[model samples]
Each structure stands twice: as C-alpha cells, then as structure tokens.
Target: MFTGLIETIGTIENYDDSKDGVVITITDCSPILEDVHLGDSISTNGVCLTVIEFDEQRTKFKVGVAPETLRKTNLGNLTTTSNVNLERAVTSDVRLGGHVVQGHVDTIATIVDKKPDGEAISYTFELRDKEFINYIVHKGFIAIDGTSLTITSVDDSKAQFSIMLISYSQSKVILAQKKIGDTVNIEVDLTGKLIEKQIESNLRQQMNNEESQLNKLISSIVERKVKELMK
Candidate 1:
C-alpha cells in the first residue's frame, strides 16, 4: 500500500511499445530509487508498477505496463518526455501523510477546468467512467495521478469533481503542469468502496432471509386450509 504522497517527479526517458509489450523507462528518480531493487513496487502516475529493471546509477528504472492496465489508466497517454508522480511503498515506521492509496487506478478522468484560487489552483475533472462518480464525495480523499488530494466539490450531473492544490503541491506533482484536456489516472477512496460493498451485501442477505420466512408462512397457510377443506 501507499500513502499517495509524491516523493518526486520522474521524467519518461523512453516509451517502448514493441511486439513484446509496452516498457517505460523513467529517469530522474534517484530520490526514490536509492534503495530500489528488481522487485520493488513504485506508484507511478497512481498505478502500482513493479521494477523490472534499474540502472546501476539509480537514476532510471523500467517497468512493463500490462494491456489491461493501459486501458484502465492514463499511462497509455504518456510519451517519451512525459512526467509522472513517483512514490515508494510505505513502511511501518512512516507516518500516514496521506490516505491509504493502493495504486490501483479505477479509471481515467479528463481535466475540464482550471483556474487560479489565490496562491492555490483549482482543477475540475470529469470522470470518463461516470459510474465511478458514486465513489466520489465532497471533502473526500482522492488520488489523482498518484498524488493524494481532497475533493473540494462534486457535481454528479456533470460527473465532475474539483480539487485545490496549494503552491507547495503544485511544484511537487505533475497535475499542476497538465492542460485542461489532459487525462489523469483516478483512484477513489478505498474505504468508501469497501463500505458500499458491505452495505449492498448486507441488504441482499436481509432480503433473502425475509423471502425464506415468507415462503414458510405461505406453506403453513396452505396446509391449514387444505386440512379444513378435507374436514
């Protein structure tokens, strides 16, 4: 699991899409790659990717993106020079600076609006998969492009949500550099999803139990009516 706090911004050195598959090489990651190993997981643009290879200098690393992951995230939109938010998996000793981020992007969202809010900047994104909007809420936590942020407002009708980034965050993550039409990987709050699932399961079980009890009552009534008719 991750905390969604970006450690550094890594630049895409190479984006190779060969017949074998897509392999991305990210450079300028020395800040987070100091203790990197072959199997270490990195949150790149809000997607958990394993380190397939790394340079001896610890400045660059490569990861292979699966086909399904490409479809579900905005990673496919990255080019040779794209910048991505980078974060290492959290350890037990580290504080939970941000909410728990699994680096499992549910879908992609398009930047619909951008405006200056004093020293901060506000961005509004329209979700591509509108169904996921149910998971977003006002003042809820969200991970956009691997950077944890709080939702300032939500518009269900437009399938959009807004977030404000302070000047400090603007310099740390790639979101501030993106254009209005650019897309970013989105991971809604995990706790909300879990709660919704649990509620649905409980309601379903309750309905089943009620149906069984009703069936037993009907059977009992039929038996009593048949006995009276025979008498």
Candidate 2:
C-alpha cells in the first residue's frame, strides 16, 4: 500500500520491450532508494513495480512491467529522460500523509483543461471509462501519476473532474511536464472501493433474506389452504 505522497521525480533511463514485458530503468532521485532491497515495490507514475535490480552507487533501479500493466497505464509510452512521479511503499511507523493508494492504475485520463486558480493551478481531466466516475466524488481523494489530490469538482455527465495543485506541489512533482491532451495514470481512493464492496455485500444479504421470508410466507399460506380443503 502507498500514501500517494510523491517522494521525488525520477528520470527514465531506458525502456526495453521484449516478448514477456518491458524492462524499465529509472534514475533514483530520492533517498528512499537508499534502503531499498530487491523485490521492493515502487510506485512509478502510479503503477506498482517490483524492483528487479538496483545500483546504489549509480542511483538507478530496474523494474519489469508486464504487458497487461503497460496496456492499463501510461507507463508504456515513457522514454529516456521522461520524468515520472515516484513514491516508496509506506512503512508501519510513518504517518499516513495521504489517502490509501494501491498503486494500481484504474484507468488512463486525459487532461482536458489546465488553468490558474488564484496562486494554484487547476487541472481538469476526462476519463475514458465512465463507469469509474461512480467512484469519484467532489472533494474525494484521487491519485494522478502517483500524486494524491483532492477533487475540486466533478462532472459526472462529462466524465471529468478537476484537481487544484498548490505552487509547492507543482514545483515538487512532475505535473509541470504534463499539459493538455496528455494522458495520466489514475488511481481512485482505496477506501471508496472497500466501502462499495461492503455496501454491495450487505445489499446482497438483504435481498437473500427477503427472498427467504417470501418463500416461507408462501409455504405457510399454502399449508392453510390445504388444511381448509381437507376440512
């Protein structure tokens, strides 16, 4: 699990595609990689990638991206020198700065608008998967390119939402590298997902109970009718 707080921005060094998947190498820009071990999970552009190799002295690490992951996220389009948001998996000791993020990209969203909002910048993104809009709410948390942000507004009819980025965040992360029409990997709040599942389960149980009660009532009425006929 992750907190969606971006630690640093890493530059893509190489991306090698093979029959199995794509092997990505990124230049480590944050100290988080200092204690990283093999098999450590890293969030790159909001996609959880396992560390296959690391070069501490050179400040680099490699991750293998499967074809399915490539198809689901914008990671496949990355090239050398491309900057991406990076975050290490949260430890049990650290404070949860951001909302729970799975580093699982739900869908790719396109930036439809970018404008200044007072001292901050606001970005409007349109999602291709309209069904996912149900998971997004105004003022809810969402992760874009691994950076957790609160939704300022949501347009369900257009399948678009806006997020406000303060000047500090804009300077810290790689959002400055993006512009209108660019695609970004998106991860909705994990808590919302869990709540949705729980609600669905409860609804299913209630429906089952209602069905059982109706069946029992029907059986009781049939028994009374049969008794009357016998008398």
Q: Write the per-residue lDDT of candidate 2 for residues 1-231, one digit (tens) a residue.
A: 888899888999998989999999899564767788899999999999999998857488999999999889998889999998889998889788888899999999999999998899999999978788989999999999999899999999999999999988988788867899999999988778899999899867766785666566877899999999999
lDDT of 2 at 135: 91
Residues 159-209, model 1: lDDT tens digits:
999999999999999998988999999999998899999989986776678
Error of 1 at 66 (Å): 0.3
Q: Which 10-residue window in model 2 sums to the lowest lDDT? A: 206-215
Task: Give me candidate 1's TM-score against the actual structure.
Answer: 0.90
For every candidate in turn, the CA RMSD to the true structure comes to 5.2, 5.2
Best by TM-score: 1
- Superposed by TM-score, candidate 2 places the C-alpha of residue 9 at a distance from the truth, in angstroms, of 0.5
Off by over 4 Å in 2: 28-30, 56-58, 211-231
